[model samples]
Structure formats: structure tokens, C-alpha cells
Target: MNLLHANDRPGEYPASYYAATATEGERFAPLKGQVTADVCIIGGGYTGLSAALHCAQAGLSVVLLEAHRVGFGASGRNGGQVGSGQRLEQDALEKLAGKDAAHAMWDMGEEAKQLVRDLAAGMGLPFHAGVAHACYSDAEVAHARRYAEKLERDYGYDRIAPLPDGLIGSAAFKGGDLDMGAGHLHPLNFALGLAKAAAKAGATIYEQSEVHQITHGPRAIVQTGTGRVSCNHVILAGNGYLAGLDQKVAARVMPINNFIVATEPLGADAAGILARNVAVADTKFVVNYWRLSDDKRLLFGGGESYGYRFPDILKTVRKPMLEVYPQLRDVKIDYAWGGTLAITRNRMPCFVRTHPNVVSASGYSGHGVAMATLAGKLLAQTVQGQASGFDVLAALPQPRFPGGAALRWPLLAAAMTWYSMRDRLGI
Candidate 1:
């Protein structure tokens, strides 16, 4: 079963809360004949749209092709947290890429958040501030405090503060760190704004134009079912949905399914769950993330499936949401959906030059909201012959799955199952 069409219809966005709230723009016609451009972008999520907008602003001819609608994938369906720093903490990054390089990576991460903030502000998007990292154990709470202090002292970043025990309430959370600089928003709206900006800046966007094959050379030819794009450079930004398009990206960036559920409006009671209107992500291998929508519905995301098809979305996600907010046990679920996102072995992004003229970036490991947007800007820079930022990310190590493509899902399922068990046992 192709993951692209496994759980959703072709050319349509998932019936997600984001889709319901998102403002639909003028739909672009699918590619039906050959076209030429300086750069061809595959995928229409934050990454591709950001790249298209920046490249067009730089006066480069650009064509962006999306299999479905823009932000139809994880970009629109995610929990909408704009997290600070890399997915892996800075100390871990220091060990992975050394101090100076890690610091540089940290700066890049800050730039990523700023880009999202500035873009959303310019578009009048509903961007809010506050992300609380809830801890389940004393050990985790201690670590959160230490990490916040380390970030302030070493990186000169000081937006994060530890949450008091009383503020954690009956959610069973011990303590946590609140990052005022990081926040959440209507993810689909942000993506659509980027699409509009890209189009205004002169990037051609083609919806329902899925790329089937790419012929790499001095000039790359990207083939769709009914048309093709001949361009000097091609960017692979499809992430988990780009199944079998490039073996290099497939080998390193494996796909996984995550589910989310939105509850009925709880009115004033919603404040009891999250007193500060901040997003909360717990300390679990299978992370449980949630936040309140502008209308007071709880948008909670949790559970992971290793299969091509999603399990029952409503049932799979509701269990975790209840665990986090038992007060909502009787609340009705208004929306539930599943989305596939790519992940790397180390949970860091996979930025690679598959071919000299082709670059692919994915495997954000649940941190794509900001990083993927930043990636698009970096891709635009590389196309303009300024690759210093892109080079830093591409140099990070990405190891292939031990079982390769065919058996990767089974291996990942086994490993994740074990970790989930450990999480239950509090190990």
C-alpha cells in the first residue's frame, strides 16, 4: 500500500481540525504539460513553500508541485508547536557535532523560530506564545531545570522558566519548563499564508501534480503523470509522502504515523486543563502533546503506528488525551485524524545532497514546524550559490536503518514498542 494514498484521498486535505479552520486560497491547476524553471520543488508543505517564496524573492524561476493540497501532510496536521532549538537538546547536539558546531546549529534553530514568527506576523496569522515541557518523573523535572539553566548560561538564551508544582494541577505532571519564545498556532493557516506569499513573489505552484520520477543530470527533469518540469536544480521536500521517489532519502528518512484528536469546546473549563493557554508536551518516547484551540477545543496528539495504514484515529488518540486530561473523559470528540511524518535514526533532521544538483531535507522527527520552514530558506540560499547554512545541516550524520527499506518498519515497530513499554514502567 502506498503511504501517500493509504489513509487519505488524492488531491484532498485530511479531515483534520486544521483543514476545517484553515482558509482555502485559490487552488492552482495541476501540471498538464511540460514546463521549465530554474528550480523545481517537490512537496508543498512548509519546506517547499518557504523555499519557493524565498527563491522567487531572489528572482529565481521556480515551480512547486504538490501531490495533494498544500499543507496536506504533517505540516498541517501536526500539534502546531513551534519548539525552540533542535529536536535533540543542545547538550546532546554538543556531543553529536561538538561545541562550536552545536552552537552554530543552535543559532540556526533560533533563526528558524524567528522566520516563522516574522512570517506569521506579516500574514496576520494566529500565532501565540508558550510551550510547556511537562515532566512525568522527578528525574525528568530535575533535568528540565538543569537544561533550562544550561541554555541560559551557555547559549545566552533565557526564555524558558520552570513551572511550579501547583501550576501543574491534577495532570500528574511533576514540573516542567515553559518557553515563552516558542508557541503554537493554526498550522494550516501558516502554511497557506506561505503559499500565498510564494505565489505573490512569482513562484508557480501546481497542486495534485505528484512527481513520479526524477532524471538527474546537468539539468534535472522531474516527471509527473501528465507533465514534466525541466529545471537546473530540484529539491526533494516531500518528506514522508515522497515514497520511493528517491532511494537515498528513503533509506535514511523512514516514515511513521501519528494520530491526534480534537475535543468539543470546553468553554471556561479549558483554562483548568492548561491554565496559561500554553502547549504541553510530556516526557514520553511516544510523546503526548496537546494545546487548546482558539475556540477552546483540546487538540491532543499522541500514539504512533508503524504500519502504512493508520489505526482507528479516534480510538488511538483518545486514550492518551484522557491520560493527560482525565477531566475531559466525557467530552465529545469533534475531530480526529492521522498524519505520516519522517524520522531519522537519531531523531535529527536528514539534510543531504543526494546528487550534486539535487538536495533533500526531511526526518525532522516531530520538530518540522520550524526546522522544515528554515530548510526551505536554506534550499533557496543553496540554489543562489550560498550554501554555508545548508552545509552545516547536511554535514550532520544520518545512518540508514539496519534492515534497509523492506524491514525498516518491522525493526522500528519492535524498538518503539520496547521504548513504549519502558515509558509505562517508568524506566
Candidate 2:
């Protein structure tokens, strides 16, 4: 897909409020020769860095290789909402994984939330908490109602509060489900903080180092352009970037491109428009998620597809934003960018050991920021011989998208088109 070269042009950062406000750090030197470690992690995004952080804390030697730079992929560019739960609701998860397993999964969601906070605190990053979902449609509100009730009754979830439409105070949105625990963050800042923590904890991270091949064994050898590392275990945290890396891992999770656009500063009117200062997302197959940056700019994200091609990010994603809040039509878009995330057909994440010495976790479907951090912890546990938690997660039934490899893209496009159509029509 030429992902490495696609968005490398000058000013690709656009005017993203994140880029403007980020605390830029010294770049890590690229891998130039052979190396070895207790564990070698591919992809230096959140998952790899988190895994490296945990493993390094456990006093295990760790080496991490990044194709570009840390936080260069979706981990850096995401809408920055630390969304709660698995991609699906509690009822659907319980129905699929049975009552006992579902309970375990529910607790894991809370763990994911806590993990982010712990990382922030441990690394001295300012992570302001306040993540909420604004239901843009009446049907979406109904789903949120059912979801909240199911969480309370079946999963013992009590943190969610439903805001009535009248109190929501925005003619733009109908109503919303307020999850005070699920907060917004500056993703790049958070990721850089973690990378620094991991490095300080003794994990060696190399940027511009791509793992091109793997020699499998009890101790697998991870070979990159400039070096090779032999480790007792390997972790694939690349997500969508794993596209051409490994066929087996790539086959299970399809890479889907999602884009986000940022608007000029909205000022104190931010709290006036939202009132509660909570992050918001509408419930739809192709969801519309938006949040106010620390600087008060509207950073909104929408648009998903199997292909990697992205339009003018500002123009492509602006229409979707305006559809929900027509008042935003006149708002000047300052930055627009896109990154790919892996999405399984079931909309549930999968963690699998593709081979005996190697394990991979991807397909968080849009719920990765939290899940990926949790998965990294699980990966550490598995590598340390405490496989119970990791095994339970691996047991989740994740079906591959229907269709042969050659037809997967077309098949997904058709299904997504229909689902989006239904969302638009409220069917």
C-alpha cells in the first residue's frame, strides 16, 4: 500500500492542534546492526511500546523496532478518546461468549481504562479525564439506553449516566450517554510519554527499523533492514501496518483506513456548546466521533474503508461532521489526517498465537487504544508463563470476514456501504 511513503510529504502534519501543542522529543536512532533481547517487539506504536514497558519493568530485556517513528501511526493520530468497552455492547458480548466469559470481559474494559490512567501518572503526562458519547440520532439514544441498562444489570457497570435530550443543550445532537471515566487525551503526548518510560525502564527502541522477516523457533529471530534480534517470544503490535509483513496475521485482520479533521479554535464556546466538557461519539456502523482539544478546537473523526487511499482529509471528513452539526459548515478546518486501523468482521478484537513461539494481537476494530494497552499487558503475562488472562482473551470467538482473500475488500465495501446506508436511514 506504500503506507510508509504515502503521507510523508512536507506539512503532512497540517495544522493539527495535537502537532502544534505536542512536546517534541529527540528522535531515536535507526537500527544499524544485529541485536538480541529477551523479547523483540515489531511496530513501535502503543501496543509494542506498552508491551515493551511492561516487559522491561518485569526486568526482561526488550527490543522494539518501529517502521517509522513511535506514535507515527493511528496511535498518534486517533481522535484521542479513550473509549470504554469492547467494540460491541455487553448484551451482544454475553450472548456470544456466554455469561461467565462476558463478566470477565466486562472487568477487562475497566482494566483498560485504568491502564491508561496508570500509564499517564507513571509517565507524568497530563491526561484530562471526561469522555462521553453524544447520541446524534434517536435510534442511537435507544441503543445507548439499552446498553447502559445491560451494563448495570448483567455486567455490574454503574459509571454511565444518561443525559436527557433537553439537558444535552445542543440543537446539534439529540442526547448522549455520559461516561465520566472514559476521557479524552492528547494521543501523541501520551504515546511519547510511554516510550520515554519504556526506554527509562531499560527497553531498547529503534526507529526507522522495519522487521521484514521472522525465523520461528522457541526463540524467534526478528530480522530487520539494519539488524536482527533473537528473542524467546515475539509480539505483532503493528495493527494495520502489518499489511505486507506476515500473510497469516494479515489474513485475519483487514486494514481499514479512518480519517479525522480538526477545526480552528472554538474558544470558551466549547463548554457552552457541550456544557459538560465530555467527549462525544454517535452510535452508527460508521460512527462519528468528535471531541474538543485542550486548546478548544473541534477534532472530529469519521470515514472508513478497506482501501488505503485518502482524499483531501479536510474536505473528505468535513461533510460528515457538518451532517450532524450544520452550524459547523462555516467553521474553518485547520487540519485533516488519516490512518489505518484493523477491523475484524465481528467488530471484536482477537489475540492469537499464529505459531508456537510467536503471538499476535490486532483487530481491535475501532476500540484499540484501550484494548491494545490491555492486550500488551496480557502479552507480558503470557510471556511470563501466567497465560490464564491471555488465554481467556484468546478464547473469544473472532471469525474472519466472509470471502476469499482476493474478494475481501469488495465484500467488505459492499457490507459497509449497506450498513452505513442503514445508519443514515435509521433503519
lDDT of 2 by residue, 1-427 (tens): 4565565542133245666777875488888777888888998778888999999999999998988878877788887788777887777888888878878887888899899988888767766666677776787778888888877787677778887454333576677678877886788888788799889999999888877888888888888887898888898889888866667767778888888888888886666546655677777779888877767787889977666576677776887788866777787888787887788767787788888867788888888888888888888778888778788778887777667667888999998899989877877
* Candidate models: Cα lDDT each: 0.91, 0.79
Candidate 1 lDDT, tens digit per residue, 342-422? Answer: 899999999899998898889999999999999999999998899999999888989998898778899999999999999
User: For model 2, what is the alpha-carbon lDDT of residue 97?
Assistant: 88
Name the candidate that leads on lDDT. Answer: 1
- How high is each candidate's TM-score? 0.99, 0.94
Residue 81, candidate 1: C-alpha displacement in angstroms: 0.3
Q: Model 1, residue 425: displacement in angstroms?
A: 1.0
Off by over 4 Å in 1: 165-169
